[model samples]
Target chain A: GESVGLHLPTLSVQEGDNSIINCAYSNSASDYFIWYKQESGKGPQFIIDIRSNMDKRQGQRVTVLLNKTVKHLSLQIAATQPGDSAVYFCAEKGANLSNNDMRFGAGTRLTVKP
Target chain B: DAGITQSPRYKITETGRQVTLMCHQTWSHSYMFWYRQDLGHGLRLIYYSAAADITDKGEVSDGYVVSRSKTENFPLTLESATRSQTSVYFCASKWQMNTEAFFGQGTRLTVV
Candidate 1:
């Protein structure tokens, strides 16, 4: 069965510190991965994404790292801010190119302390 | 106005009532998806369409129906709404499977 899951359900970090969220995927055929952030009462927003061919991809304030060997994915946020406090989800898509093949993981709730 | 959008951002329906949620995207994305977001369960795929007139069931599509007659529109219907089906529904679109998906402001559907 193909599934994506997070390593932690909650994380607390001090503002201006860094935060790391982790996810594990079971499908070896998954070739693309994405990280999304969801604020309260809002839909999840795309944060970053990486292809299986690449180990890492950097965005403005976030970076996505892919470890294909362990089927693990991680999102790193630098200088965590209050705006960064939200539930973050990791999604994966297989090589089949079917939208049905995309899957999302239980999110990690990030709390940033002032 | 240039991205995906979902209609009736909030809805309250009684059980056994049929409700349809509308989704429209301006990008004409090749892939469209419907997902239900519940506490602890994250976002579970309900249905998806690869293109116009091409639809497929997703992990949690049993209680829902979807149709994509136009490339820019995909609508999900709940023939008989259930209490368990009360969850925030999100519509997303992507130009390709390998690209990042853009989600519309979710529609908070509550089945009373």
Candidate 2:
């Protein structure tokens, strides 16, 4: 079965440094991808998203890069902060699927040190 | 409220008991989804609804059922809860298939 996966299970970074999270999706037909941030004891919050038509998309301080040929997705966060520490997940939506059904990765725990 | 919300933020039940988690959204989105989060499994889709009376099973749908009687509500019911069924459930809604989805606060269920 096709599934979405993350490269690293945990990431440790110093404050003010840059952080990058990698994800790999097995579904080639997936057209939409999203990055979500989940804090302790809370639901996942939408961060950024990109469509297959675009290779890269940037948000306030985050950038999402999509590589279709390699089936890879990456999220880069600039100037890591202590508050940025949380679990991040990458999700993909297949084009053939109806509605907004999405497959989520196991998630990467980001720890920003003060 | 003006956003997605889940009822009974936390619940504890015995095995074989039936439990239902309620999810409601004010945006009237066309798509609604139910997912469970475990320690190492992240979020696994349980079921989804495209519109009123239109529902489909997702990756981990067994032992669970869902219905979308109206556009603003989608409830997930566990017919026979088991210890393995204990997890944090999240409900999400999006306007379209390619758009970002907003999630509810989450419901924590413990089955003993």
Candidate 3:
């Protein structure tokens, strides 16, 4: 039963402050990881991604850090805004083309208090 | 650009009923995927297609079926709807492996 899981089910942060969400996966062979932001009643939006080879990757005001040794993944947002309040998910890609094997974490509900 | 879109934004059905969720993408990406999002769970891949006429199942594919007749379309079918199938379905497309997936608005299906 290999799966990806989040460290926190919900996180509350002050507006303009930084926020960090964490995830841990059980699959050791997973080579790719991605962070997705899902607004209420909407589909998950791609935020950032990092491969197993690299420890960190940065995007516009966002960063994804991967720790292959511990099978941990994290997404860091530079400035927490009201619009950033959403459920963030972390997904890990499996080795094969099998879709079911690519697991997704339960997600962390990020709340930015404005 | 309407990168991806799912039809029947919401659906309601009874047990044993057959339902199909439609997903359309304008990007003509090489990879298309179907995922389900539940209350506590994030997005779980149900199926994916590398190209037209090629489809594969994901982790939670038991009660679902998918087909890609054309590159721009990938649809997921629930042969027999159940209470367990009540969730939001999302369709995503990616240009290549390990790339960011563009997601659709999602289809919320409720089985009574």
Candidate 4:
């Protein structure tokens, strides 16, 4: 069995502070990982992604870090804002058999306080 | 350009009735996936299709059926809807593995 999980269920931060969301995956064979931001009543939106070959990838205001040796993935949001508040989920894609499938983490709720 | 679209954004069906959720993608992606989102379960994959006429079950596929007659469409049907089948269903499409997937708004199904 494979599992992907987050370090915390919820995170609260100030409007101007930085926020870090951590995810630990159990499958070492997973070669690709993605971070999604989901707002209430909406579908998950693509944020950033990192491959096992790379350690970090940066986007508009978000960065994804991957530590393959430790099977850990993290999403860093710089200067948190009210718009950044959402449930963040990490997903890993792997070749389960002949086909490919993606497994999603439990999700970490990010709440930014004004 | 519409990336992906789903029908019946909100649905309410009976427990024993049959319900089908439609998913369509305009990018002509080869891969399409159906997932249900629950409070504690996160997003669980129910089924996925690699191409037209080719489909496979995912982590949670029981009580559900899927068909990909065309590459642009993937539909998920609940043979007999149950209270447990009530959840927000999402459809996603990716050009290939390790690529970014575009998701539809999602269908909220409530079984009574």
Q: Which stretches of candidate 1 lie over 4 Å from their true place?
A: A95-100
Tens digit per residue, CA lDDT, model 1, A1-114: 677999999999999999999999988889889899999988889898898999999999899999999999999999999999999999998854364466889899999999
Better-scoring candidate (lDDT), 2 or 4: 2
Among all windows of 10 consecutive residues in model 3 chain A, the one with the lowest summed lDDT is A94-103
Off by over 4 Å in 3: A96-101
Cα lDDT tens digits, model 3, A1-114, are: 788899999999999999999999988888888898989888888898888999999999898989889989999999888999999999888764354335788989999998
- In model 3, what lDDT does residue B60 have? 88
How close to the true structure is residue B52 of candidate 2, measured as C-alpha lDDT? Answer: 96
Candidate 1 chain A lowest-lDDT run of ten: A94-103
Isolated chain B TM-score per model = 0.98, 0.99, 0.97, 0.98
- Itemize residue pairs with steric clashes in candidate 3: A99-B58, A100-B58, A100-B59
Ordered by TM-score, highest first, the candidates read 2, 4, 1, 3
For residues A41-60, write the lDDT of model 4, one tens digit per residue.
88999999888899999998
| Candidate 1 clashes between residue pairs 3 or more apart in a chain or in different chains | none
Per-candidate TM equals 0.95, 0.97, 0.94, 0.96
Flag regions of model 2 displaced more than 4 Å.
Answer: none
Candidate 2 vs candidate 3, DockQ winner? 2
Best by DockQ: 2
Mark the 10 consecutive residues where model 2 chain B has the least summed lDDT.
B92-101
Q: Measured with DockQ on alpha carbons, how good is candidate 4? A: 0.78
Candidate 4, A28: how far from true, in Å?
1.3
Worst 10 residues of 4 chain B by lDDT: B94-103
